[model samples]
Target: MYKSTLALAVAVGVLAQQANAAGFVEDSKLSLSSRTMYFDNDNRDVKRDARGRNGDNRESGQGFKLDYISGFTEGVVGFGIDAQALWGIHLDGGKGHHPDNSSFIPSDTDGSAVSQWGRFGANAKARFSKTEAHFGSALAPNLPILVSNDGRLLPQTFEGGTIQSKEIDSLTLNAGQFTHAMGRASSNRTGLSVAGGTQDSNKFQFAGGDWKVSKDLTLQYYYSNLEDFYKQHFLGLVHVLPIADDQSFKTDLRYFDSSSDGKNGEAGYQFSNNGGYAKNTGEIDNKTWSAMFTYTLGGHAFLLGHQQIGDDGGFVWLNQGSVVDDNGRNEGAGGASFYLFTDSMINQFARAGENTTFGQYSYDFARLGVPGLKTSISYLRGDDIRNKSGDGSYNEWERDARIDYVIQEGTFKGLGTSLRHGVYRGSGEAGADMDQTRLIFNYTYSFM
Candidate 1:
C-alpha cells in the first residue's frame, strides 16, 4: 500500500506537470538541518516496572536531515513534490539502552545502540482553485484530534494522503487518511495502535475545519478514527481580546469524546484504560476537556489552565507499538501526542477522573537587551485520579523550566540552543517519580 500510494502520487503529479512547465524548476528550494540532543530520565521509587524501563535511562544523539521542495507548475492544476532524507547517529548511550524504550536513539539487535540509522520519504502535491491535495508517506499534521510528536531527536512521519481547502474566506477545511507510521525511535514503518495493546490498526481517518466567526473569534471541530482501537471527536474555541496596543488576552477551550471500535474488546486488543477508571472494564470510553487563558504584554506572557478527564476512562491517542520489543526489530510501539495544555515535558495528565490545574510564565529577554533569548516556567498539579478502588484516587504534580536562545547575527545567525528540566512526583497509581533533562542544539540552512 505504501509503495502503491507513492507511485500513484508521482503519476498524478507527473501528468499534471506536463501541462505547465513554467517556474517549476526555477522556484525549487533545498534545505538542510542538524540537531544534537541529550536526554536523561531518572526514575525513582514508585510502582510497576515495564520491560525496558530502568532506574536511570540516559542517551545522547544527533540528527541531520535534508529537504527539497519543487514549486508548483503554472496551470489550472499545479503539481509539486517534497522529498526528505533523515539520518540519526548515536553519540553516547552505554549498555542497557534498549531499543524498545529509547526514543532519541535507535538500539541495535543485541539491545545496544546502533551507530547510525536513516530513512527517506516523498510527498506529491497538487493545487487547484484555492485548494490542495498531498499524497505520499511524509506528513506531519497538527490538528485538534491529533498532533505529531517532535519531542525527541526526530519527528514522526505518517504514510497517507491529506487535503486542505479554502474555498471560502475565513474558513479552512482539512481531511486525511493514514495507514502507517514511522516512529521517532525506529526506522521501519508500522501500523498504528494505542497504549496497553500490541495489535496494529491499518487505518486512521480524520476530517475537520476551522471557521472564523469574526476577527477575534474562531471555532474548530475535528473527528478522528484509528481502526479497531478507538474513534475520537474534538471541539475547540479561541477568542482574543485586545486590551491595548501592546497587551491582549486570549481564551482557548478544547474538548474530546472517545469510544471503542473494532477489535477494541478482543483478547489481544483489549485496553486497560491506562491504569485509570473506565465505564466498561478493558475498553475505550472517555471524555476530556480543558480551558486556558493567556495574557501577553510587551515581553511577558502569563497563562492559566484547567483540565479534567471523565471517570469512564483515560483519554486515548495513537501509539505505534514502541513499547513492545521482539529481540530488537521494530514492531512499532511508539509514542504520540494530542491537543492538550498539560502535555508538558514530563507528563500527560489524561488519566480517568483526573483534574489538573496548571500555570506558566514566560518572558522574552529581548526586552532586557538580550535578543533571541527567552525563558519559561510552568507547574501542574493533578488530583482525584480514579483508582481501582473506585471511590479512592491518587495525586501527582510536575514542575518544568525551559530556556532557549538563537543566534540572531554574526557567523552563526541561525544557530539555536535550548535547555529543559522537569521534576515530577506522584502517589497512588500514577507510577514512579522522576527527573528529566534535555539539551538541544539546532541549525538550518536553505538554498535555492
Candidate 2:
C-alpha cells in the first residue's frame, strides 16, 4: 500500500511541475460512474457446505467509480497521469445466502459478507510520438493473452508497466510485465498464480502485436509467460467482407499453444487442467483452436463458432484462485477470464479433449423504432470432454440471454439498464448444474 501511495505522490509531483502546460489541464476529464446490481445463483445439485447449507448464493450491491484522466503535457516527450477510485457497498445478502467460496463479494472473518470496501489507484504515463508507456496498479489490459475481468461490481486490476507503439503504419506493438492483481471484490492485492497452485508467482511477462494488412483484414500474435507456471503463444486472424450496403460477413480464427514452464507440476505449482483429464497431471501441455463467423444484415446479427481442445490437456490462462491471505482467507482473486467465445456467462466450455459448438442471435430494436433497446441470446454445447478417470467422456451445455436499454432522451438520457440470465447443465466430471441471473443499472456523470 505504501508503494502505491508513493508512486501516486511522485506522479502528482511531476504533474504539478507541468500544471501550466497548454494541453495538460485544458484537456483533462473527470467522471463518476454508478452501478447497482442484483445477482442470484442457484445450484441445482445442492451440495452442503461446512455449515450444512445449500450451495446457493444471492446478493445485491452498489458500486461507484471515479476517474480522472489528464492530457499529455505539450512537448516532444509528453507526460500525464490517470487515477481511479472505486467503492463497493453490500446492500443485501446474509450468511445463509453467501457461500464461503463466492467470488461476487468479500467475506468477513466470521464467514459473512462485509458491509463495504474500497480502493484507489493511479497510473503514471509518458508519450513519445506514437509510442506510450504506463506504469501503475490500475492497469486493465484487454489482449489476446490476458484479459482483465470486469464481470462483477468492480473491475480486476494489475500492478504492471506496459508499453504500446504504433509508430509503424497499420501496426501496433504491445509488451508488459505484471507482478500483482487486485480482485474485483477485494481491496487487497495478491501475487499472480494459476488455478490449483498454492504458491504465487511474481512475474508475468507478455509481448504481442496486431498488424492490419488491409482495409478488412488483420493478424495478431502474442507470447506470454507466467514464471514457474506456463508459457503460451497465441495467433489470430480477422477478416470482414461486405455483401451489400447494409450487409456484411465477418470471420475470426484464434489458436493457442501452451506448455509447462519452470517448476510447473511441482508441489505447489500444479495446474488443475480445468478439473478435467490431463495427459500428465498438473502439467501444462495443450493446443486449442477456435473459429467464429458472423453475418449481419440490417439490425440483425447471427453468429456461429466451433472450438476444439487438444487431447493432451485443457486450456490455460493467468488465474489467481489459490492466492490467499495470511489468515488463509480467500483474497477474492479466484475468478478470471480468457480470450475465447467459450468464455460464456456460466461455464467456460474448455476441457481436455472437448469439442464445443456455439451460436448466437442478436437484434437492435432501433430497426423497429426503438433506438435504445437491444437483445441477444446464445447457446453453447460441449461434448467429448475427457474425464479425470480417463474411462469415458462427458458433456455439458449452457444457454444465456440478455437485454439492454439506455434512456435516449430525458433527464436520465444516459441511464442504462440490463438484465441477463444463464442456465447450465452437465454430466460426469463437469461442474454442478446451475442457473444465474443478474440485473444492473448504470449511470455516469461527467465533471470535466
Candidate 3:
C-alpha cells in the first residue's frame, strides 16, 4: 500500500501542470459533517471492577469529519485524490465509566478518557474509461465479502489497493489486497486479524463481482481470506417484483462457507470458535445461510427472515484489533458490520447450531405528509445454540426499536436525528441480558 501510494505521488509531479489544469480543481468537492451521540447500555449481570463498582455504562460524545475529493484529471490516465479527517471529543464519561468496550472515545495510558482524538488519511487514484484504481491508507469498501463499519462516531478504514472495473455493462468487478486497518477507536492503524487472536495478519486478499441479470434480479459472489486465520466464500441473490405502483415484493438470499487455513489450529495462532460448537476445537469450520422476504405498500413495510448456523461453528468475518497496544488487553478493535440483516444493534446470533427467526415492521410517515420521518421495530429469536460443551444448548432473543427524522425544508434542513433502543435476553451464560440505547444528531454541509 505504501509503495503504490508513493508511485502515484511521483506520477502527480510529472503531470502536475496538466493534472491541475485538467478537471481536477474544477470538479473537486469538500464536505464537513458533525454528529453528537448519547449512548447507554446496562448489563443485567455485570461483573465488578477492581473498585468493586458495577453500573450502566453511559457516555456522550461529539464527532466531526471533513472530506475532500478531487475529480480525475483530463486525458487517458487521469489522477485524483481523496482525503478524510476525523475528530472526536469526550463529553461525559466519568472516571469509572472507562472500559475496553467504550470505543467511541480515546483513553489515556491509565485507561481514562482522553479530552480529544483525531486521525487523517489520504488516498491517490487513477482512472481510465470505466476502470479506476485506488491506493492509499483509507479505503471504505462496501462489498458482499466486506463492509466498512460506520456504526460508531468514526468509521473503520483500511490501507491497501483496490481496482474496480465496469467495462462490461451490468457487471461490476472488484479486487483488493488490504494490509493494515485503522480501527474506529484509536488514531493509529494496525494489522488485520480475527476476533480472539492475539496476533495480527498483514495480508488479506479478496475478489468479487456483482452481475445484474435483469432489471429486478441480481447475483453476487465474493471470496475473502485472512492469511493464517480463515478463508470465506459468499453468495447472494436479490429479486424484486412490482406488485403495484406503490407496492412491491422483495426476496434476498445469502450464504457463507468458511474454514480454517494455514496456522489457524496451531498454538499461538489458534482461533477460538467464539463460544460456539466446533467439530474441531480451535479452528474455523462453519456454513451459514439466510433467506428474507419483504412486502412494501404505501407507508408500511414488513420483513420476515430465517437464518441457520451450521453445527460446526459460528459465522466469521474480519475483526482487526486495536492499534494502541496494551499487551493485547483490549479486544474487539472497533465497530464492524456483516452482510446479514441479523447483524443488529446488539447481538449477532452467529453461534454454532443456532437457528434464528426474525421479523420487522417499518413505517414511512411520508404518506402522512411527514416526508422525513420513519420508524421501525424488529424482533429476533435464536434457539438451539450449541454451547462449548456440545451437549448443552441455549437460546436468546432481542427486540429493537428505532426512529429517525430529518428536517426537510427549513432553516434546519439536512439536520437529522435518530433514536434507537434494544433489549436482549438469553437462557444461559452464553447470552448476557442487557438494554442499550443511542440518540444521535447529525448535520452536514457540502462545499463545492
Candidate 4:
C-alpha cells in the first residue's frame, strides 16, 4: 500500500511538472449515464419469422466512465497519453425484454443479465509542429470503409495507430492502421473486420486529406481499405454563403464510392464466389450525400438538412463495429455525445430501396433564458432497399431528439448533461421497428 501511494504521488508530481512546462498534464474526469431502450415491432403480425432471433424487447441500463489525458513532455517533440475506463450495469430488461438480434447488453445463456462489465485502454501520442500521432487500444474508428457501429448501448473501440498533420496552410492529412477491436459492451479485444467478415487479416488501412480553399469554402478527400474486405473513397465540400449582415447559410456536401478489394476485391471476390461470408463476394458501388444550412437570428438558429444514398449495395465500410464513443475529431467518449450524421438507424446507407432523406431543426435556449442549454429534433425516412434476387424493396423511418446542458459558472462550472431519444420503424425488410433513449450526465474536474 505504501509503495502504491508513493508511486501515485510521484506520477502526480511528474504530471504537474510536465503540465507547467509544456501546457499539458495528466488530468481526469468522470461521467454517469442512464438509458431506457425499448424495441417494438409494428408489423409483428405480418410474419412471426421476421422477428429475428431475439424477438421484440425493451430494457433499461446505466453506465459510467472515467477518463484521463496526460500532459506532453517539455521538448521539441512533445509526448502525452490518453486513457479511458468504462463500465455498465443493467438497470432493467431481461431476456424477454430484449430483441434476440440486438446485443446492446450481454446476457447469460439463461436469458439473464450478466450483471456488469468493464473495460480500460490507453493511447500514447507524440506531437511535432502541426502533426500528431497516437497508437494503442481504443476506439476502432469511423471511416469510409470501416465505420464502427454505435446502435447498441455502448460505442466500440479498436486497437491501432493513427497520424494527423496540418503543417501546410489549409491542408490536413490523416492516415492510420487498425489491428483489433473491442465492442462497447465488451472488454476483450478481437480481430478487426466487418460484422460478419473474416478475422484472419487484422489490419485495416486508411489515409485522407482536407483542404481549405477560402474562409467559407473547404474540400476533403479520404480513402480507406479493409484487408480482405472493401475499399472506399470519400469526397466532400463545405461552403458558407453570406446571406445578409448577420445571416449566413452553410452547405455540407459529401460523397462516397466503394468496392471490394484484394482477396475481397471485385474480381477476387467474384472468382472465389462463396469464399467470402454473407454471400458478400463480388463488388459493391455506392454513394451518400448531404446538404445542410443554418441561419441564426437573435440567438435563434434554424437548420435544414437533407441526405441521400444511391442504392448500389448495402452501405460502405469504415472499420469493424465497437462500443467506444467517438466524435468527428476521432476523440473517444464514454457518455452519449456523437458526431453529426452518425444516426443510430440509417447508418452506412443501409436503408433499402434506392433513396433516403432526413431533416432537422434546432434551437438555443440561451436566447430564451438558459445560457448553456440547447435542443434539436430530426426526422429521417428511407426507401428502396433492394433485397437480394431483386424480389422486393424495404423502407425505414426515424424520429430523433436531443437536449443538452452545461454549467455556466460557480463551483460546478463546466459540468454537462444530455438526453437523446430516437424512434425507428422499418418495413418490407428483415429489420425491426424500435424506440431508444439515452441519458448522460458528465462532470470534468481539471487539476491545473
Q: Model-by-model lDDT, in order?
A: 0.83, 0.91, 0.84, 0.59
Clashing pairs in 2: none
1 against 4, candidate with superior lDDT? 1
Mind giving the per-residue lDDT tens digits that candidate 2 earns over 15-53? Answer: 899988988889999999999999899999977877876
lDDT of candidate model 4 versus the reference: 0.59
Stretch of 10 with least lDDT, candidate 1: 46-55
Predicted candidate 1 versus true structure: per-residue lDDT over 1-448, tens digit per residue: 7475659666655756463587667778899999999888877773334645563668899988899887788879888888889888889985554434566676666656788888888888889998999887778888887788888877888888999999999999999999888887777888777877777887899999999999999999999998998999999999999999879999999999999998897876777676777777768999899999999999999999999998888888887753455674443226688789998888888888999999999999998999999999999999998875564469999999999999999999999999999999988677679899999999999987
In model 1, state the lDDT of residue 228: 91
* TM-score to true structure, per model: 0.94, 0.98, 0.96, 0.77
Total clashing pairs for each candidate: 10, 0, 0, 31
Tens-place lDDT per residue, model 4, 1-448, is: 2442354445445545566564464333333443334323222333344434445445666666566666577688876767777787777774455543335566544445556777877676778988998777755455533456555555577777899899999898889987776766565565654433433357778899879999899998888877776677888888988877767777877777666666654332332211111224344455556666677665666766666655445554443333222222111221122223634432333532345666777788887789999988887766665655543366667788889999999987877777777777767553555566556665655433
Which residue segments of model 4 deviate by more than 4 Å? 1-54, 99-101, 139-154, 198-200, 244-246, 265-282, 319-353, 391-393, 407-417
Compare the candidates by lDDT and give the number of the best one.
2
lDDT of 3 by residue, 159-271 (tens): 88899999999999999999988877668788887766667788989999999999999999999999998999999999999999999999999999999988887765656
Ranked by TM-score, the better of candidates 1 and 4 is: 1
Candidate 1 clashing pairs, residues 3+ apart or interchain? 278-312, 320-332, 320-333, 320-334, 321-332, 321-333, 322-332, 322-333, 322-334, 323-333
Off by over 4 Å in 1: 2-20, 46-55, 95-100, 322-325, 328-333
Candidate 2's C-alpha lDDT?
Answer: 0.91
